[model samples]
Target: MSKRARLLAALVVVMTVFVGAPADADRGISVPAFYTPPSSLPSENGALIRSEPLPLALSLPGLDGPLPGRATRIMYKSTDNNGRPVAVTGAYLEPTAAWKGPGKRPLVVLAPGTMGQGDHCSTSLALQRGLILGIGVTQSTVSIGYEVLAAYRLLAKGIAVVQTDYVGLGTTDRLHTYVDRVDEGHAVLDAARAARALTGTTSDVGLYGYSQGGGATSSAAELQASYAPDVPLKATYSGAPPADLLDTTTAIDGTELVGAIGWAVNGFVQSDPSLKPLLDKYLSDAGRAALKDLSTMCVGDAIFAYANKKTSSWTTTGQSIADVLRSEPVARAYIDGQRIGTTKPAGIVRVATGVNDNLVPHPQARTMAANWCGLGGDVVYVPVDNVKTPSPLLNHFGPLLSDQGTAVDWLAARLAGTPATSNCGALPGQ
Candidate 1:
């Protein structure tokens, strides 16, 4: 090879080596360009558009059940799954009649699990019922209908809730990280920072999420102390979060959900460039086609694309997806770079999962509990019992919402100056 060409190839090799370094090894990924305050309104045509005092007669059909106590639309910017600029639009809800006085209420940031792709999926109008709680899911509709009702109950208690439509999923940016924690966590916490920066703000805040939201919430909590110290974080509740990315990758080795795993790989790769070569090499034409086509696709759409389609000896086209993911420097870096538990002494934290959680496994939560306690972090790991089944939603997604009351009570106490407990005992039992 010519000297210049050899030099170029050498540079590429060097870049790959540094990009794939471990979590604390080196911060190799390029930081995103969007440093706009989270409170900035969305650019026109963005996935999450902000319009304060949300129109009562908006387009969403399922949001007419009850009126929120108090509501306002918020515009903010959160990095997309690919670490690009994504304008986030949200609705802040507070119970109007519950706390009639001028006292500031505790704020709750609700990061929801996965939902399908569509305009209707990013509904913020559900906050109309109150408590900053409402439908948070795919870009169109929520994964579960009753979640809106639960938000209403929480709002009635005079809490501020900020729900985020994760970076790319709400609008069309071409990637949703699935369970990739860091980016999702940044978006989730920034929403709170954005909400706090708004004209009317609060001092105390907490976070709540299920499934994908669980992972996002956990990440946000871990990074909360250092990332947003001014805004006190009382507690964080995550249901069935994929806490350990490496373990999650192993658990879903050859399952139908391998397609979702593709999205995760793409997300991590986008955030850190080192994995690009691996993605380019291991991903077959079919795999590449799947990633390109599904970057903007939602949950159901991805499932449809990879269903029963096989390449080589695998049952589905996802085998190549996993192969590329395992070989990539970016994947190795991300798995090693996960920022779980506390980044700097965090406040109270709670994680709950069904013993049978299939998508996000109970073992992951158990491991998280142990790690946090080992770090001297106050953690509460609740094992949800009602959802003791093998169904996808029941096992992985339902536990977070199943014991909503208990989780909320725990948070409420923490915000009320009550110290939280750690589940150090349950860690070994599992």
Candidate 2:
């Protein structure tokens, strides 16, 4: 067994002792009506479709009530990559702590790091229950309690948070557009707009995310100017954004999260069906089955199913997923279109990455920061200098745990109207 699989085994043992059924356990165990989209959506982007008070399980005792805040599960209208209106699901938290900052409360849209492609794996569900178990015969799920800490930290600082489920993670209308830049960006921006519509107040907005969420926020930062100019961005913190698809796929292959390559293929084809035939031509029978299997899997299931595997095993040509992309111009063009740093992002931004993040590759992330810097954009590029770990996940997750507190503080400072700093002068050395 791989070190990654062994670590997952250890986690399962630890989590099994603490895991309990959630209060509002997704009706996926039965039937989920809340996840079902309506026949028609609100015409305007960011328009609120529906909402209900959502109870949170991780609240703390306070003089008034809970230390963090109240939450609402919301469905809101947003445009997909196809230019059609889609109803995206997410959670909106009204912070209980007093905002000592300079504005009338700020909203930070927390794009969750890769939560699964399944409806039950939504991060909103994690916020409600503090843990999630993906019940399947072959699929075991990791507890998502860790990721919720970032949201709680923001809420404690009197910062409102909106955790987007992206295009389809929770909503059952379509397959989750995993890593699709436009869909993820629209989901992030519209989430902020939806929160303001719910509160009926003007609030400064920020974007915070890591891993897949990092890619989403970075894309959102770039897309905000032309896509949703009405939604002003105060700050953006994108940790380990997967800017280059070929590099990212190459890094993940033969690792714990090898199944992620399947996710990228599934998502890219969904966004532009024009590539479907080409994908069909290249995938082996094993590849087809893997895609079908991974479409419904969480991190644990994926790790268990495809750890230490390679995309070459899934292809008819035996070419790795990266080579497959290089083999076709249409496919290569699609991948290039997903690349970040093409245009200047709208707001003050901070891009941080683990120097040894084998999962997302550190160079592509640093390249994004440098690209923004060359555009004369205000950017803070942080290299989470950590020693290399043999475990890919540790190499990736360590920096997230260590640097997130500082990243959150930096964003909070931006919201408080602090004069932003740029390391562009020193970027050339990197």
Predicted structure with the largest lDDT when compared to the true one: 2
lDDT of 2 by residue, 165-261 (tens): 9998888877888989899999999999999899999788999999998999999999998999989798999999999888998899999888888
Cα distance off (Å), candidate 2, residue 367: 0.8
Q: Which pairs of residues have clashing backbones in candidate 2?
A: none
Provide the overall lDDT of each model, using Cα atoms, as 2-decimal numbers.
0.58, 0.83
The C-alpha local distance difference test score for the whole of candidate 2 amounts to: 0.83
After superposition, candidate 2 runs with Cα above 4 Å error: 1-31, 134-145
Backbone clash count for every predicted candidate, in the order shown: 12, 0
lDDT for 160 in candidate 1 is 66
TM match of model 1 to true structure? 0.73
lDDT of 1 by residue, 233-276 (tens): 77888777777776676555444454566667667776667777
Q: Write down the lDDT that model 1 would get.
A: 0.58
The candidate 1 region of ten consecutive residues with least summed lDDT is 24-33
Candidate 2 displacement at residue 224 in angstroms: 0.9
Name the runs in model 1 displaced over 4 angstroms.
1-50, 55-66, 78-86, 100-103, 116-120, 123-150, 171-174, 253-256, 303-320, 327-330, 342-345, 386-390
